[model samples]
Each structure stands twice: as structure tokens, then as C-alpha cells.
Target: NVDKAWDPIRIACHVYIALHAEKNEIVVEAETDDDCTTALGRIRVTLFHAEANERTCRARYIVEPPPASYMRKEVIGVEVESAEIAKDRLDRRVKLAGPWLTQKEKEDWEQKRKELMASNEKVFADHLGSAFINLCALNSSMRMRVQFGNIILKRYRTEMAKPGFAFDKFVNMMGQSRTGADFEKMVGGIELGFKLIHKIHQSPDMFCPLDNMTGKLSDIKPKQKLIYRKCGNVSFRLEADIDITVRGGEYQLGENSLYKEDSALKKRLDVEFLAFNSKFDWALEIMTQERLSSNSIAIQATAQDLLSSATVEQDVMDFPYPTLGPKRRLNGKDTANIHTIFQYKLMGTPYVVQILLARGICSDVVGYCGASMYSTNWDDHMGPNEGEICERWKLGSDLRVLFPLPPSTKQSSFATGGQVVDKHEGFRAFLAAVDKVQTFLSEAVSEK
Candidate 1:
């Protein structure tokens, strides 16, 4: 098909690699006409390997023209060069998050990485809080926490939207027995479940992730990786599950209002971290208790349960029995007689998100409100593989500011704060009137 003047110097080459086999082919064509449609010589190249598959090994080949008088088909020569292994090749894939640490921080992290790799047992960080001191800076931690929180919310919303959706399925996966029917009654009713409720500053901008998230997270931010080692970057994952059950025993809305003394609350939290590069894993369980004084009261827990002393506590500084630490937000005056209950379980969700970055991978009871910790090994309670840290923590304005209160109630300061509407307000008013009259009659008799 030659259409142009012969040009032996010009050669075109293409290579094709077979997916299912180790064989690769390289084609060489020499143009011989001006039409660019004719080739005077064609040579086919085939590669053969002694022990390598298509998945690994690098290859190089060479081709030469045959003598003019001795040609018996085109001569193609192949040479085997040293092949590079897969692990040694340059890796050019997307990384989650890294290259954010300073030089000194990277060096420090490397030393720690070496230590962790050398140890057979896991390194435990009991009260894993968002302490800006950890390798993951405070700003980075917050960004990632908000991102992960949004993911959980999105997944929840998607699943709930489907037909025959049940919240109990998620709870059960987290190892709980409560069903969807039970969850609806705890927060008043299905309509009231997950209502907008805020605490602390109650500013919508500062607290809620749902409204603030611009888009999905491409990669979990504030991720860490050891500079000296080949192990992959250390990333974070977050999950939130909730269950609302009646206190002491299950009760209907109107049937047991008078007989019930309080609504006992509980938080069953499980935190775990697995370090593949370090070859270790750490995990722990947390159980918390609280109570709402009565129905119709928006905010209802004790000060110890509402503030920092509930989840993050200082054993030496706070009262001994409560064993609480400093408050994340709010003062004594702010929490005084404030109702801690809300239409939705908004308050607890943020804490679950923040605590993931609190410390290293450890199983301890440090960042939970009125919580107790349990472990398989009793000796490891206080340290790695051990016992509980046992400190109380209060929810702060930063976590509460996301939820804005409805316009109907503006007289209150905190979103959760409001006037109580007792179910038997009229009866209680009548009883007060009768008590005043009886007191006046007794005073008159004494005077006579």
C-alpha cells in the first residue's frame, strides 16, 4: 500500500499489553509513500519472561533492520533487562491527608512510630480528647470531625428515606436491643424526634454540621502519617448510634405520667482504633447515666450531667463523688435551673464526633458523662489495655451552637432553656389556693 517515497529512517511504534496474560506486543511500521497509507516493512515484537506475570516487572526491548541481501523475513532481536519489582516502583496514588505537619512534628511522629512498631501491645490513650497538643492540630481535627459527622448524617438520612426503613437496624448493628417503636416514645413522639434543640451559646453557625457542610469530604482531613516509615497514613473514621428507651420500665404517654419519678438515660459508646502498620488495636466501652425530671420540661438533667463534669472530669479539682473536670462551656449562672432536655438528641452527637481525636488509641473512661468503663484485662484499666480513666465532661457552646430554637420561645437564653408546662398545672394551682386559706384560718384561731 505504498503511496509515498520510501523513508526507511522513519519508524512508528505502538505497544499493547494483555490483561490476562504476561505477553506484550510492540508493532513497528515503516512508511514508504506520500499518502501515509503504505508501509514497506512491518515487524512484530513479542516479550517472554521466565518468572514474572503481567501484574509486575518492567520490560525493555530493541529492534534492528536485516542485511539487504540476507533478508529471510525481518529480523527482530529482544534483550531481557533487569525488571523492577512492584513494591519498589514509584507510587502515584491519591493520599487521604498528610504533608501538613511541620518538620519537627514529623520527626517527633517518626520516633513515636518506631516505638509503636517495636511494641507488641497497643499504645493506649484513655481520654482521647480534641487536645490541640496531639499530632493532629485542633483546627484540623475540627474540620475532619465536622466532615465525618456530615457523612454519618447523610448515610442516616438516605437509609431512613427508604421504604420499610428502621432506625433499630443501625442500633442493633451497634449491639443494642431497642426497636424503632421504642425510640419514638422516648423523645415524646415520632414528630418530636430529632427536633431542633440547642444549648450553650445556641448559635446555629458555630454548632451544626448539617447546615454548614458545603459538600462531601474527599478525604478525612487532619490525617497523620509517619515520615520515616512506609506504612500508610493514619486516618480517622467516625460513627454515631442512639437509642431512646423509657426509664426503669416502658411507659405510655398519658398512662404513667403521675407514677413515673424520672426517665433514666444511658449512653452505650464503643471506641476502637486499628493500626495496621503498627500491628496493634485498642478498644473500650462507655456507659453513661442521666435523667429527665418530668415530661414537658425541655431541659431536665442535673448540672453535673449538663456540663463538662459529666463527660470530661478532673478527679483532684472537682467534687470527689462527681469526679468531674472543667466545663467546655457555660458557667454556674448559665446552667442554674436550665432545662437540659431537648426535642432532638442533638447535644450528644457532637461529643461523639469530637472525642474521636481526643487521644491515642486507648480504651479508657475519660470523656463520657456519668459513665463507667469495663475491659477484659483488669490490670490495664488505668493504662494501655487496662482500666477506666473515669472523668466527667460537659457539652460546650461550640457543640450546642448549631441548633437554633423556634421563634415561639424567645424569652429563654439557651435553646434548651424554657418555661415548664406541667401536665397538671390547673390542679397544682387549686392546691396552692387551698393551702393559703388553711394557713389564714389557723392564724385567726391562734389570735382568739
Candidate 2:
């Protein structure tokens, strides 16, 4: 479908110029037959006459066959005219036949040549060099001009075929360059690094506990060790349960359980203080230094707390504890009295007990105690007691007198037969106590 005739004409013109244009000058002209339907055109080229005077010739060309060409049939008649025959055509033809440059032609060529050279020199000087660099000057309107300025410079270097160039070093230099805006670029890299570190640190598989144990007994296995995948720019510590078997016993016991139990008791003394230092260390590394925000810390803490709480619940289910109060006393007085003083009056009272219970310490006892604490105080306050106020007074007290007394008890009568509180109700009460503490802190902080 492509027309090939035009290709040869183009090639012939190029060849004529290359061969004869010593000074690299081109001259174009056209000629036509009688009907003007067929036209022939040629280009005369001349090269620099460095050794010759302005009037003398250095190199010239009347292209072979004069670089002849004809126009297509359709437009030829409308656009072209026939060659004149009145003049001494044969004589003129003979004189111009050899495709050589004459003295006068050479003089005229030299004059025009000087003008063109001057113009080109002026343009090159005005641009200060290649047009490409000028196009990328600092004030360009294009947005990409700024964003990709370094990229363009790098590409130019590659085009020039420079060897041993390091793109990362180049990019770093550009990011810190004094010539243009760079804060965004530098921050962009920092942000990317932060995200990558966080993702690697947070992935569960990064700190997997590899073991050969499988099947139903895997959960009860005695020996389990943790292995961490290699990570860069970050450090981690395992705070998880590890089960180790005793030499004489067939059973594998949770080594972490003892630690968790002791830690839990310490938690009662001050839950916030128990892991204070470690938590702060993690926050400093993962948040401030690593650029993760405080919100990330809160999320991780919530997840850990939820998981630990669930594990504690499972442990309690596996091993039940004894009920509170004397079993033989049957007037319901012993249970009622314990419930009134402990459950209602001192259940969630802060500093009453410095020891934290591992498996709810006394799960049944605490529930009864909390109920008694609430009941005794309910009539006096006519509302829920402030949990936060109590916790603050307890935890934030002087070191010498860390323990505080619970609310004073008042005598209250209860029916001989009354509905026993359900487990769900007890849990709800516990959560209420926790919520009151949280709510008070929230309000206090807001006021500040």
C-alpha cells in the first residue's frame, strides 16, 4: 500500500548533497515541460571554501542529472509551467552541464553563506548551548519539568554514554540538592521506609515458632522455640508463651505461664506500671524513631490485651477454683456478709489489694465482692461510684502509702430469698467498673 517512488527521490537528493556540498550549502529550483504537466527539480549544493578566498571555490555541486525529479501527474499542470525556448537554451545547457560551481555563483554562495553562519552562531550563543537544556530551565511551566528534572539530567548522562554511574547516589544527591525544592522528595523516601518497616514488623509470620510437633498434641508440646525471619532496620523481642517439657514428666508445661502469672499479680499492683518501661521502649523505637504514630502503638496494645484476656479465659475454663466463704455456714449470712463488704464496698476499690490474681485470683470471690461494693455504695451515691477517681487515688498515691482504704460500709438488709447474679451480669459489672475508670481519665485529660 505504500508508494516507493518518493523514497528514491528523497534518497537521491540526500546523496547529491552529501557528495557535492563541501561547504554544506543547498540550492533548490524547479523546471517544467511544454504543458507544464511534467516538472523536474534539482538541488545544487556547495561546501566550505576554507582555503580559498571569498570569491574562490572550495567545493560545489551541480547534482548528477541535476538531482532531477517530476511531480505527480494530477497537480503538475495546475502548479507548473513549461521551460522557455526563446533564449539560447542549448548554449545555456552546455554551460551548466558539468554540475560545477562557477566564479559568480561561488561569490553569491559565499555572501549568503556568511549571513546564514552569522545567524546560526547568534542562535547557538543565545541558547548558551544545546536547546534541550534551555528547554528544561528552572522556570519552565511544565510540572514534570520540576518533578523529573533530575531524571532528565540522568537520561542525558546515559545518552552521552557515561560509565559507572550510580542512580541511587544520584537520586540521593538530587533529594538533598541545593538547586531546587527537595523536602518532599526526601520525605517521600522516609515515608516509604517507615511503611516497609512497619509491615515487616507487624507480619505474624516474621516471628514464627517453628516446630516439628503436629496433630492434637501440638498445642500441648513441651518444647517450642521461636524463630524470627531476617529483617532490616528493625529489632524485635518475643513475649509469647513457650512450652518446655520436664525430664521426668510426659507432660509439657507452659514456661511462659509462670511468668504471665507473676506478671498478672504485679499487674494488680499497677497494671500501667508493670510493662511501663518495655512499652515505652517499643513506642520510642517503633513510633518516634521509625515514624509510626502513637495511634499505631494504641492499636498494637489493644490487640495484645485482647489476646491475653482470651488466653486467661481459656485457662480458667481448664482449671476451676474454689468458691468464696465457709461452705458449712448455711444461713446465707456468710455469703451475704462477704458480698456486702468485699463485692459491694471494696470490689473495684483501688489499692485495697496490691496483689493481682493470675486466674482471676478469686473469680467467685471478686464477683461477690464487687456486687457487695456496688450495693453498699448505691444507696449513698444514688449513682455509680467514680472508678477513675479511685484508681488515680490508688495508683497515683505516695510511695510510702500506696495502699488506700475502701469506702466505708453501712448496714443494709437483704431478703432471705433473692435472685443470684448470673455470670453475664458479673462480667457486665466488671466492664462497667473499667469503663468508669476510662471515662474519668478521658474527661480529666480533656479538661486540661
Candidate 3:
């Protein structure tokens, strides 16, 4: 839970600062692989006293909450013992399935689980040990001071109110098995654990922070070559507000009132790029600039091979689903090789990701945004036969990224009420929530 909350708080503050005390707008082009469908969306962000908001956000987080303060020590000890018992049961179950295991795939899950457990056990044990010693070494007054500090930490109540905060901590401390390999190996198990928690807790935003934190943790750093390397064939447009005709792919479009650094529309477009880059691991390059009749700017470039040269199996799972029509709903996770076409800057800009599927592999053309099974919409020409012939295969989940959500400028509002939206609505919810918070705070302060 601490780890999950950590990212949003950090990001919310980071974005609040990044807006630079200005109203910014973003136009997003969310598309599926097929190139047949796209969602055109726009977001407007208004920052009120951004400088003061940033400070308020920072100041609100000044004090720390004691880990698991609500649970009594005895309760914690019981939970620790229960986790060990569950681990034993899980070990036995995995062993029972050994008859089905192949020689190459023969691996013990217990080892990974142990590592995760040890990390948590060590933390809890340290706290217990301190308490044991403190009983004799520290007086009542000292304990009172500690307890009082936790109570006075003004942000603790709001932080704890975040959806699924308690359950998140519980899973981290007890449900998760530590594994060294990245989330690729851990996602299935992790998702199952989170689902179980959600079923019991029933929070609308139960898994929101967990999902965001997982993505943040899973994000790989941009490589040196990946950052500026030239890409292959792709096309885009350069547009502006003025009435100048731009030849296709032949001219630079930064010389007029339309391309001014401080233009409202230009600022909005720049923030969109910032949000897009923040979400995906693509190494973007402005290949060529072209002017379309619609008075806008675009640069098109193919998704260069930014991934490491490691074998496909090492990078993404090879699990396949059967080929289906564009309207079919995906029942399970499907893995495929994906090709990204163009990253554009428009509310309705068409972004395409091609899914190359193997025999028995199918693509999910549509579904809810937060659900794991949705696909980057499919290309009409994709075939099951081609998947077997293709040498490259990668996970679709890696390519179907969530929309960008930079934190709003209002500190207390986002800090207090941001978890109401799930993955799909997150971007817009962030703007709306913070706007509401800003309004409330302004009125409250004015009344004083």
C-alpha cells in the first residue's frame, strides 16, 4: 500500500509542478490495432496559484504515518502466522501438479514466494523486536509522544482514505510471493491476488493505485540508442492556426503565429506529447513534417525497434489465442507481436498498432480500458498463418498502454479524492477532480 500510494503522490506533485502555473489543454488519439476505430478526446487543465499549490502539496506530506498503525501488535502477529500457513498450502499444491510439468519448465514457485515473504517478515519482525525492547527501556511518555505524532500527521487521514489502501498493504505484506524476474512472470499471480482482495473489499477504485504502481514499476528506462535513433517509413502532418499552405512532407512549419511558443493551442499540444511519452516506452522521432489542409502539424515515424535484442521469449510471453473477428470479446490474455505505426498530435489522430497472431491466437479488438484482455484494435489483414511464419512475437499488454494522467495543480483535491476513477476515466477524472478541489479550497480560504 505504501509503495502504491507513493507513485501517485509523487506523480501528482510532479505534474502539479510541471503545469507551470498555466492553463493547458491536451488532445489525445486513442486507437486500436485495426485502424478501423479511434477515440478522440480533449482535456483542459487550469492551474490556480500553481506555485502555492505545489508548496501546499509538499507541505501536506511533511509528516510520516507509522506503518500499519491501525493494527494491534497481536493482530499483526496472527496475520504473519496465517501467511506462513498459506504459503505451505501453496507449496504443496504446486508440488502436486509436478506430473504435468515439462523438464524445461520445471521450477518451484516457493523460492520466489519466499523472497517476497522474507522482505515483509523482516519489516514486521523489526517492529516487534523494537516493541519488545521498548516495554522496558522506554517510559509511557515516550510511547505517548510517538502515538500522538502519528495522530497529528494531517495527511494521514486523507492518505488512508485512498481506495483499497488497507487491502493493498495486506497483500504486499502477506499475499505476494517475491520473485526476481520482472512483472511479466508475476502479473498473472499478482492479478489474481488483487482480484481476491477486491472481491472481499468491494472498492470501486480498489485496484487503481495498484495498477498504476505496477505500470510505473514495470516501466523500463529509455536506452541511449532508443532515444534518438532513426526510424523506418511513417507519415505525419504539421498544422497551425494561421492560413498558410504547407506542402506535404517538404517544409518546416515552425515560422508563423500558429507555431508560436506561447500559443494556447500549441501549449495544449505540447502537453499531449508529454503525456503520451510518459505512458509508452516508444522512442519518438520527428521523421518529416507535412502540412495538411486542416491547419495542423504532424510528424510520422515507424515505431523503431526500441526493445532490447534479447529473444522474444525473454521479453514477452508467447501464449496465443485463436483468431477472431473484430467484434469478438477476449476471454483471456492474448500475446502477439505488435507494430506501432504513427504517433500523432490531434484529438482525432489515428494511431495504429498491428497485432501479428500465431495459429490459435486471436486479438481482442475492443473491451473496457482497465481490463487486461483488451487489444490494440486489429488490422483487417492480420492472419493466423502469418503469426507462425513471423520470427518476432511480443506481448500485446506491453503495447496497449493506458492514457497519460498528469496530476492536476490542486494539491488537496487530488490528494484527497483522486481514486474515484478507474483506468479508462483516469485522465479526465484527474482534471475534473482537481478542478473541483481547487474551487472548494479557494472558497474555504476566502471565507476565512
- CA RMSD of all predictions: 33.8, 42.7, 26.3
lDDT of 1 by residue, 1-448 (tens): 1112122323342222122223543233323343233221221101211111121121110011112222122111111121211122221111112123466655665665455433311111212221112211111111111110000111122333333333223323222222111000011211211121212123233223322343222211221111110112321111111112222332111111111211111222233322111111122333222212243222222221332222222222121111223333433223121111221112212221111112111113232111111112212221211122221111111111121222333243333455443322322232232223223222322332
Model 2 lDDT at residue 299:
28
Please identify model 2 stretches exceeding 4 Å from their true place. Answer: 1-237, 240-423
Q: What is the C-alpha lDDT of each candidate?
A: 0.22, 0.21, 0.21
Looking at model 2, residue 413 earns an lDDT score of 21
Q: For residues 197-271, write the lDDT of model 2, one tens digit per residue.
A: 233223333211122112221122121222111122332222223222223322122222101112111111000
Give per-residue CA lDDT, model 3, range 1-448, as digits (tens).
3123223433433321122224553222223322212111111122222221222222111111112212211111111122312333212100000023233322333343345444533443333233323221111111100000000111122222233334224233222223110001111122332232233123223112222323321121211111111122322222211111223412221322111122111110000000100111111110111112232222212111112111222112222111233453322332222211111111111221111111111233321111111112212111123342121122111121222333433343343455533332333332333233223222322332
Least lDDT summed over 10 consecutive residues: which range in candidate 2?
Answer: 279-288
* Candidates by TM-score, descending order: 3, 1, 2
- C-alpha TM-score for every candidate: 0.14, 0.13, 0.16
